[model samples]
Target: MEDVVLIYHNELGLAFRWKNTVPNADYERIQVVFRNMSFYLLQEEISKFSQNIRSAQFYNCSDCKANKSCRNILLKTPLEKMDISLNMQELSKLSDLVEGTLFKLDLQDYIWGAGRN
Candidate 1:
């Protein structure tokens, strides 16, 4: 991750961004690349995605013989442009990653007054 600054991360995935080489570079967006997919999103978009993940529901299939960790839940992105298949465990971990990143971002804004600009 030499090209990006890591915001937050866990066993499931991580959120990062390109290193700010310019003094006046924007910090309003971040890259969330993991789970074999990549997304460049704003803070609001990340928040929305976290909310949607928290609200999603999952159910086990009685007929399916696959393991419980099998990917069954289909989660749509905030803009409804992509669908991510995840198992219950994956969903939980992803939720943690997104929400944790958001928390860190918010804490930075609050402590450093980053939101003022």
Candidate 2:
């Protein structure tokens, strides 16, 4: 039905919490400069919903390209919050990805893509 993928700054070296509420679900893991379970993945177990990724979060993202390429494919994506404290520009990149949600927390100066930071 639904699932979560949490990637910390460690570059996915750890598989912390991954499970399937569905009866017959799949999963997999892979390695690459940058990867997405749908296409760039070298291998994965959730082949069924590989294209149906739901919510994903980054704890301390050191580097991420997924935020630019396919960050908003799933119109019904459960993803709402992503901790982009380092790469503020990435959140700006999502300006068109999500208009109203670009910056709503800090708006004092709102210089950095709506946020004052």
Which number leads on lDDT? 1
For candidate 2, the clash count comes to: 7
Q: In model 1, where is the ten-residue run with the lowest total lDDT?
A: 18-27
- Off-target runs (Cα >4 Å) in candidate 2 are 8-18, 30-37, 40-117
After superposing candidate 1, which stretches have Cα over 4 Å from the reference?
22-26, 57-66, 114-117
- Cα deviation in Å at residue 23, candidate 2? 3.5
User: For each candidate, what TM-score against the reference?
Assistant: 0.81, 0.18
